[model samples]
Target: MALCEARLEEKARFLCRGRNPSDATDLLQDTYERAFRAFHTYDRNAPPLPWLASILTRRFLDMCRQDKRHPQQQLTESLDVPSEEAGPAEVWAGYTLEDVWRAVDLLPEEFRDVVRLKDMEGLAYAEISQRLGIPAMTVGTRLFRARKKLKELLLKKAETGGAS
Candidate 1:
């Protein structure tokens, strides 16, 4: 409980990586409750924050699935109808943010962390290395590998017409 209280804000911010910013608070509370219920299963040797963050990540994915099933009507949807002024630009099939993140989530942990920090959070290699206690070169290398793997995954998804 004390650990949960101490890391609540940090976990919420992490959850916001894959969730609506406004829903962070509710998601954080949900994380706490779920964590408490699963406390007995927690490994004492494992670090708490990452474990909590993983739980929140799963919760965020669940919420995303839920939202997709019951999509909200957008007020700006009517404005999005194709207009005469819209040029015939090449239009690729749309992939939701969930699709992109789901691919990212499929990445190996070391690759995923650097990709998220550098690409999603917009951190520099030096900053990511410093925060993660790794070499800057390592950060760059991992990010490169991560992007390559992501591209492969997306390409495969496109080719197979799979839900990403």
Candidate 2:
């Protein structure tokens, strides 16, 4: 317990490497709460820090999976819809979520991983590099190229009336 407590902040930071700022607090809290609940299941012989880190990682992955499966929709409960003259919709309105998913899937395997980690999983380049065993610069470069390829694919789909 002492060992796990000492590494709480570090573990949280590790989990937050590429995620949204708003999620940091929740991730940290969840990690601690879970570790506390599972304390009895921990192996005394194994290193505690690593075990705690594993818990944090699992929690983060679970969140990502849940978010993917049930994406949150914008709530209209608090605001009136603006008149048509107010403004045009967002630029990405031309592409549906399914279209974006298909375009990402069409990317090469390597590029697809980078896109999924950085864009979908919201991982930081350093964290992605660490996970993939590549340099941070490589992660950045791959993400940039992946985005470019995805955009090109989406544009082509739009032109061909293939966007779903």
Candidate 3:
């Protein structure tokens, strides 16, 4: 439990990256509670992080489906915010991890998943391929494309004063 608690915030923040922070917090708490209840069933011999991640991914998907039923509950505001009095570096520093995630969300679903798993979640290409059920080579390809796309988008946004 102590170990799980220590990593809970990071796991939740990753799962909720593109979503509202409040909702992300709620989802994280719910995931923790669910993990607690199911702790006994967890295989001690198995790697816990991947197991926890599988659960988190499922829960996030469930929440996404539920959110679809209530469109009004979704955040419609543009995630990109202009830099105020702050300089570019300051504004960049002010950008939340969530903001970076919002940029990630702008990616196509396949690309987004690969980037999240590889870069954010720190999963190896083979692990990501297995988890996402894609070929390892495909994982590399997708990750390359995703990075390129994200770079383009971020650069464009920065130029337009839309991203810090």
Candidate models: Cα lDDT each: 0.67, 0.68, 0.69
In candidate 2, which residue ranges exceed 4 Å CA deviation?
A: 1-91
Candidate 1: tens digits of C-alpha lDDT, residues 58-83: 88788656554443211012112223
Report lDDT (Cα) of residue 119, candidate 1.
58
RMSD of 1: 14.2
C-alpha TM-scores of all predictions: 0.43, 0.45, 0.42
Best-performing candidate as measured by TM-score:
2
Relative to the true structure, candidate 2 reaches a TM of: 0.45
- Candidate 3 at 122: error in angstroms? 0.9
TM-score of 3: 0.42
Ranking by lDDT: 3, 2, 1
lDDT of 1 at 66: 56
Candidate order by TM-score, decreasing, is 2, 1, 3
Candidate 2 achieves a global lDDT of: 0.68
lDDT of 2 by residue, 1-164 (tens): 77666576666666666444446678878987998999999998997888778888899898767655543221110011223432233324555666677777999998998877766666767889999999999988897788668767765765676755
